[model samples]
Target chain A: MDYSGNGKQFSGKVVTVTSGKGGVGKTTLTANLAAALAADGQKVVCIDGDIGLRNLDVVLGLENRIVYDLVDVVEGRCRLRQAMIRDKRLPELYLIPAAQTRDKNAVSPSDMIRLTNELRPEMDWILIDSPAGIERGFRNAIAPADIVLVVTNPEVSAVRDADRIIGLIEAEEKGPARLVINRIKPAMVKRGEMLSMEDVLELLAIELIGLIPDDEGVVTSSNRGNPIAIEGKSKAAQSFRNIAQRLQGHKVPFLELQEDGNLFGRLARLLRPGGN
Target chain B: MHAVLIKPGTDRNGMEISTKFQIKGIREGLLVTLGDAPWEQVYAALIEHLDEQRDFLKGARLALDVGNHMLKAADLGQIRNQISERDLTLWAVISNSPTTERTAQTLGLETRLSKPKPEPAAQDTRYQDGDPAILVHRTLRSGYSLQNPGHVVILGDVNPGAEIISGGDVIVWGRLRGMVHAGAGGNESAVICALDLAPTQLRIAGVIAITPQRRGKSQPEMVRILNGQVVAEPWNPKKKD
Candidate 1:
């Protein structure tokens, strides 16, 4: 569990969480994963790659304390350490918020590479929160990633966009990217009303890292500027912590989300004996 | 004309600027062919040339023919931004390098200057006798496209959102779920066949058809123009056409 670097030759692994479709819970997942890793005693820093529409700071509840942003570091207006705001709860966790006033074109891919290279020496893990779409911002977020995690909802459109993003990643030689299915509703999936995890994995053909069930507490905790991974014991929080453990080369079993239906449905299934 | 010749002579640093590029007007817009120099030098010269002719080349749809330059996504993306800053739309990028072509396609830029050419006239017996075919061994994922003048034989799955446009027949040894246009050049004799013939859309010459959903497990099927309508039937060895 100790990923801390030795006294010399210490470099962190950069993991970027990206979803081609918007509002698929990328910022939420990034915040929770950072919190989970930091809670595990690993030094983690999260970068908000979405410039004009920054949300990672707000999600992590470090919005008001941010004196400098990522653009300031890239443009040499502020030192790299000056822009990183340490979390109040987890002393090991830090966040480098995006510039709200600048657009995506403000930072180039090489700038991102340089910035992450500067942060690699001191941290155990660096996670980048990528914006939606396969544009400049997405490219910048993924430029320096040692691992890419693609998040997608089980809907057809989101899966389609994820497919496109996976293809692009392959073309850039950044793959094979891992899959993280967020906001999954097991009840609807069991009723044939939504796409199952198998359906998504069949199309994407990538390794699965985590399956996070839908939880309302996730939204409330995010709104309260506290990540669920640190504050709540919800399934979504456990899912994020499991993913962090997996990233650290630990073997964690995937959660059995299908058994999370209503009590009556579970009893009926148990009585029916092998009746799906 | 002579005054324009001296424009690309030398910079203030006394560095000889080799701004060798040819600009031609095409149906789409301007096609700029850059010479084989170092990427940095050529890029700087191209930008300088554009800036010099700002009024003339402004608002033009440009297709750059970068000869054999193995450009990556970062390189292509940078040039795209530079091109856009000069008020030009970079729609396509023509390159001899496969890596560069794939990079351009991933960025949603066109790799070919024109669509697949129409088939030659019926009287041209030479072309009919020697129709070429290209064999692809890898799976064609989403957002990837394959366009050929002759037949296209794929040994892998054609996922949805991918496409194939061929002048001759199209055959897939694996599952086919993408769009396939056989007889793209008005050859109605072209046939499309696959182990799983569930394509997003199928076309033969000028006609297009959507494959009806299958009831049971999929079987090998072939689609062709039957009486001016596109029809698909299971491939039966003993049955006569």
Candidate 2:
């Protein structure tokens, strides 16, 4: 079967995006990162390793057109070219969708390795969207990742899961994983209702890459099958782009939207003066 | 080629087809390499070999190296099932092809023999390289045993049935409720500190200490080698200096 090598490179390296918790924006990051990288002229293919709960296709807006998936290619039922759903907007970007019917057991870690190894020769980056949980899906996604970006939010459960995932990653000899804190609510953080960046960092204690604030636009865009990162104006979009740029070896600054959530909230309150 | 390759009875030849397979211990586990021919022949030969030397290889960890025949999960699973039927654990299957490797992995088998990890931290500690320690930042789940020949600084909880073995010291930033072995390399100076130090059993150097039924208020405590014994004491900010 024609397994296309990773369509992007960094000093010719493929990086995979992963998270330990379910529904913690792994797909969102993978889709946006691929789009952002492709926008910068890097050939990228985001492989959704979350087979059963495959949402990369949906988030990337390639859901309706998916005919074959990673399992199909791995099982040799379809050619890899037949499975890769090229992005409508980006000429260089691609999406290797995951099968929605099958569970994580459908593909093995080595199948992913073979697939990624084949893709490594062709692409600039093979950004695999790892499924949540520190199980088989996680292993498959990380098996061939030259770099793993562990995504999390500023929440206790998410941070705990991230820590576990990081430990498992290190145990597998698969990390030195970088961190991406997603969907952090600045206002809640300030009032002590949410975990601040320091609180999350104290628990994770990893090199921070991107700080994406909570954006309602992400929901609307996903509903329209458009990833927010593809839209240039949105804040979350900018976050994904910066992450992609950093992955390309650019020294991008982490967004300092809020130093401590309370300060930002206090400033907002002062500016508003309780008019509404 | 098959006829010529086979040794006649027990006589001298290039390789003996009739010869019993050898099961010897390698660093990883029992290395069992089947002769290349048909899988049926190899399977039968392995069982026969096991039967003959049942006493010698009982309850041993095994790793089978099946050279380049793309085995599906069921094929590898069957081998493991057969091995388990004989009370042997098949821990790994070393393969050359990606397909075989995938199958082995799908069957939850190790792709490589467990090579002894280079004890970098341990080596660093032995040289007294500025309080060498390994830091962990996750919950140690059940059945997880971390053996560091240096100090261990954990940023999370150590659950029951988990173990931490350190040569120098062990510190849990979170609660510690596991079996811990400090002074693992027999160094008596090792100590263990935890937010709530209620361990199933704690050992330091040659001394073993039990938690005193955990009656009092929970506090950050340190267990150290005091008066030639391991003692648990309330951690004091002013005591160390």
Q: Write the per-residue lDDT of candidate 1 for residues A71-153, one digit (tens) a residue.
A: 99989999999999999899999999999999998898778888999999899889999999988899889889888999999
Q: What interface RMSD do all candidates show, one decimal each? A: 6.4, 14.9
Measured against the true two-chain complex, the DockQ scores of the candidates, in the order shown, are 0.26, 0.06
Angstrom error of the Cα, residue A9, model 2: value is: 5.4
Off by over 4 Å in 2: A1-12, A259-276, B1-144, B147-191, B194-241
Judge candidate 1 against the unseen true structure and give its global Cα lDDT, from 0 to 1: 0.84
Q: What lDDT tens digits, residue by residue, belong to model 1 across residues B19-67?
A: 4566777778887877787888778878987898899888999999998
TM-score of chain B of each: 0.76, 0.54
Q: After best superposition, candidate 1 residue A35: deviation in angstroms?
A: 0.9
Model 2 docking tier (incorrect/acceptable/medium/high): incorrect
Backbone atom clashes (below 3 Å) for every candidate: 0, 16
Specify the poorest-scoring 10-residue window by lDDT in model 2 chain B.
Answer: B1-10
Best by lDDT: 1
Residue A183 lDDT, candidate 2, scale 0-100: 89
Which model scores highest in TM-score? Answer: 1
List model 2 lDDT by residue over A105-125, tens digit each: 788776787887787767777
lDDT at A158 for candidate 1? 91
